[model samples]
Target: METTFDAADFHQTKLQNQLIQQLAAVEAQSNSTWATQQGQNSTRLAIALNLI
Candidate 1:
């Protein structure tokens, strides 16, 4: 037998895609910020230890 899909399923799929995209954007931004902070901290530590 053939099955039929509903509007609700389509809406749910769209919402899921939107949520996934938003999450990916936020995660990328967070990773960028974390990397920047880590680099800054490393520089400060090196300066303090006269390594550079």
Candidate 2:
């Protein structure tokens, strides 16, 4: 019985860690995508101003 409880706790901890890692990865990806978009917009604005 003790072994079973220990195994369950270990599994829960592992799952929690996995979820946290996944969330961090997703947040990083979103931040990167947002930065890229901002860079592109800045470039376009610069180009438009130069054209005028």
Candidate 3:
């Protein structure tokens, strides 16, 4: 015998996948922004220390 799948279950799964993808994208953007800020800070510190 074969089992049947429900439409609601499929829809819920799709929605969860979409949310996961969106969260991953947001995380990547945040990390990129943080790295950029760190680089800028390092540069400023170097200039202040007269090491650049």
- Clash counts for the predictions, in order: 0, 0, 0
Per-residue lDDT over 1-52 for candidate 3, one digit per residue giving the tens place of the 0 to 100 score: 7577789889999999999999999999999999999999999998999964
- Error (Å) of candidate 2 at residue 34 is 0.2
TM-score of each: 0.77, 0.88, 0.83
lDDT of 1 by residue, 27-46 (tens): 99999999999999999998
Worst 10 residues of 3 by lDDT: 1-10
* Cα lDDT tens digits for candidate 2, 1-52: 3445677798999999999999999999999999999999999999999999
**TM-score order of candidates, top first:** 2, 3, 1
> Highest TM-score: which candidate?
2
What lDDT would each prediction earn against the true structure? 0.95, 0.95, 0.95
The local lDDT score (0 to 100) that residue 2 gets in candidate 3 is 50
Q: Worst lDDT window (10 residues) for model 1? A: 1-10
User: Which 10-residue window in model 2 sums to the lowest lDDT?
Assistant: 1-10
